[model samples]
Target chain A: MKLREIKEILNAEVIVGEDKLDIEVKTAFGADLMSDVLAFAKAGSMLLTGLTNTQVVRIANVLDIAAIILVRGKKPPAEAIALAKDVHIPILTTKYILFETAGRLFAKGIVGCLEKVEAGSERI
Target chain B: MKLREVKDILEASVVVGEEKLDMEVSTAFGADLMSDVLAFAKAGSILLTGLTNAQIIKTAADRSIAAIIIVRGKEPSTEAIEMARELQIPILSTKYILFETAGILYSKGIVGCLKKVDGDFYK
Candidate 1:
């Protein structure tokens, strides 16, 4: 889906990347813990996080994430926004909590990056 | 540097993927915060974290990490180990604190995942 559609779907405000809302998003990863996002998020996937810090933008850049959606009405600090801008990463914000945001995205066919594990699959 | 060299450098014990220790690591990321790891770690780089959970392994697998080294003497849960083994991502353990471990590797020329910001370069 286009990031513009994501903004509409989540009622999100674009804090940055307003000019880049046409970016396509095939997958999304939502996590409060950046470690989980780093280890699990796919490159180019949109990151939905609640963490409001400069590290968020730094990691997103390292992971090559398309954009960041800060949930639960959390406003990122100026440093975070500056970093995002420096890296050309889009940042958005939403009033919905993490679970609600994830649920909405999942309901719309957006999914997390976890590799599917079929039941009774081979164990390592 | 080879993963084996990292093992030797840190005196880490291989909990899994001992055979894959020959893998080369050009960069490394050390963080307790998984967010930092995900945001900054380069693919195929070694992950040094103190967090011992299945999510760690899951995230590493998602990020295509070469391996995971649990720092500060933390033991990963059975589930975490099984996940890593299933994903074929090696798991190692070290007694060094995060800073000391990072310092040891940095001294050996292992660098972090952060992008270099040149000073006075039009920031």
Candidate 2:
């Protein structure tokens, strides 16, 4: 699905990268733990996170994430938004809590990048 | 709903607080971020999270959470289990991803303790 559709479904406000809303994403990884995200999130998957810090923007850039969806109505600080714009990473904020955000996206055919965690952080 | 009912719905295991399965919980707050959980989680609500560290137990204890539901098939660290035992907080493990877990629980009438975050973490 395109990021544009996701913005509509979640009633989110685009904080950055509005020009790139046409980006297509089929998989998503949700976590507030940045280490878990770095370890497990696959490239190009939409990252659903509760953290609104600049670290999120940096990590998304490193992982080549399609976009960052802030859950629970959390908005990134100004510095984070600035970094995202510089990195060309899109950020969207939604009022939906992390659970509902994931549930809604899953209902729309978006699935987890991985269903379960295996030992050693390896996809077994 | 009772913790037992949640277990049945999510096919979860009672890793701790097994004897307390009858405990009723109608609200939940899901997040892997400890700070967010601490800031927003209300007392007596189930905590749905992807994190399994001992910090989770400590945070839940400080906030007086009803139970901790470890989603995405993640198990609490042994330290977390021990702490939960000492704190008397129930810990449940489920194979469903966080999203699926929330969907099922919401379908069964467990709603978010706080639907959205207001400014300055006021709500």
Which candidate leads in DockQ?
Answer: 2
Best-fitting candidate, measured by TM-score?
Answer: 2
Ten-residue region with minimum lDDT total, candidate 2 chain B: B114-123
lDDT of 2 by residue, B1-123 (tens): 998999999989899998999988998888988878888899999999988989899999999999999987788999999999999999999877676687677767888887767565663
- Whole-model lDDT, candidate 1? 0.74
Q: How much is the lDDT of residue A113 in candidate 1? A: 44
Model 1 / residue A10 / CA error / Å: 0.6
- What candidate 2 gets wrong by more than 4 Å, as runs, is A120-124, B120-123
Per-candidate TM-scores read 0.49, 0.87
- For each candidate, the alpha-carbon lDDT, in order, equals 0.74, 0.87
- Chain A TM-score across all models, in listed order: 0.90, 0.95
Worst 10 residues of 1 chain A by lDDT: A115-124
> lDDT of candidate 2?
0.87
lDDT of 1 by residue, B1-123 (tens): 999999998788899898998888877665555765665566987887768999989988999989898865668999999998899999999865443465466667766544221223224
TM-score of 1: 0.49
Tens-place lDDT digits, model 1, residues A1-124: 8999989987888998999999998777655567656655668888877688999999999999999988656689999998888899999997654434654666576664433212321231
